[model samples]
Target: MRSIITISREFGSGGREIGKKLADDLGIPFYDKELLEMASKESGICQELFVKNDESYTNSFLFSLVMGNYPVSADGRINPDMPLNHKIFLAQFETIKNIAKKGPCVIVGRCADYVLKNEPNIIDFFISGNTAEKKKRILERYDIEKNKAEDFIRKTDKRRASYYNYYTDMKWGEAKNYDLCINSSKTGVDGAIKLMKAYIEIKEANADK
Candidate 1:
């Protein structure tokens, strides 16, 4: 199997579950919010700051300038002029690379796939779902109402897309940017997992030739 699996997913698409299940099934480590803690520790940034900027773009003009004015890294390598968002991204990017180097892992979100795009053993996947299904799932899991869930999904997806597009050369949720794009609403979580397992197995087996 591939040494690294990165899953990019819509907010309510059950992508984290898939990644966790895949990692469990394959006996590899799974990472999601755990990455935030790593970046926090490794970068000397507070855990709360990482959580605040996690997968989010800096939108305030003045705020951006202020954060940019004091840019620095944990080890003092990054340029001081860099923005806070960029610093956090660099921290996560570095952390992702380090994790992948340790061996196979299933990482959900945080643009791990894009961060490791040059690596040969990495496989990337994007998971989306039907609007209704996404809304339903969101409503059930969160305190959001039916109407709010729709708006929440749209806003969250947009933020994720913007964050991704800002960091990577490719567009978010685009099929060409990933090895596979699956509609979990149709395939369901287990079915999607099955498909990914088969696909990864085939790809890895061929690599052995």
Candidate 2:
């Protein structure tokens, strides 16, 4: 049914874990860092470079040129004159679209919600938590002292927001931007997934009617 789930998450909200579990439960492919690899392979760029520059803003023309926006030769290599970042952005954009076209899959981060905003079967969710809960999660996962967790969360979420804001017109973590704005601290990770599944099913049933 062309189900594409896009999850936008706060730092340490366990959204990635939820996405993986959801995909496993639904028996569908899950995409996260793997998307970067696929995009790199498809665009003929170095995988490490792709991951480094992936979703990263580029003001440099050279960076944009290597990314492949220029016309390709008969052999599919980008023309010599194009900016790398532009090329990479276009390639990644196309890759994301292609993945979505394949049907139901879970995509985490990378402004995927905005990418698939127009798709009828797409369900966009934003997972967030109270500051204390988020900090605790980060501290435990990274094995950091509690005092450092707040700063880490702030910096991480700021980077995510910057990345998302640069690529899309929508604001990151805005409730209105998503179909479901879940507070993971309240629902917990598994509960959030269950709620998301139920929400999707209800929406689909209503659409069918």
The model with the greatest TM-score is 1
Q: How much RMSD separates candidate 2 from the native structure?
A: 3.8
lDDT of 2: 0.82
Per-residue alpha-carbon lDDT of model 2 for 2-51, expressed as tens digits? 47999989989999999999998888999999998999999897788778
Cα lDDT, model 2, residue 54: 58
- Best-performing candidate as measured by lDDT: 1
lDDT of 1: 0.84
How many clashing residue pairs appear in each of the predictions shown? 0, 17
lDDT of 2 at 119: 90
The ten-residue window of minimal lDDT in model 1 covers 60-69
Report the Cα lDDT for residue 131, model 1: 94
After TM-score superposition, the amount by which residue 186's alpha carbon in candidate 2 deviates from its true location, in angstroms, is 0.5
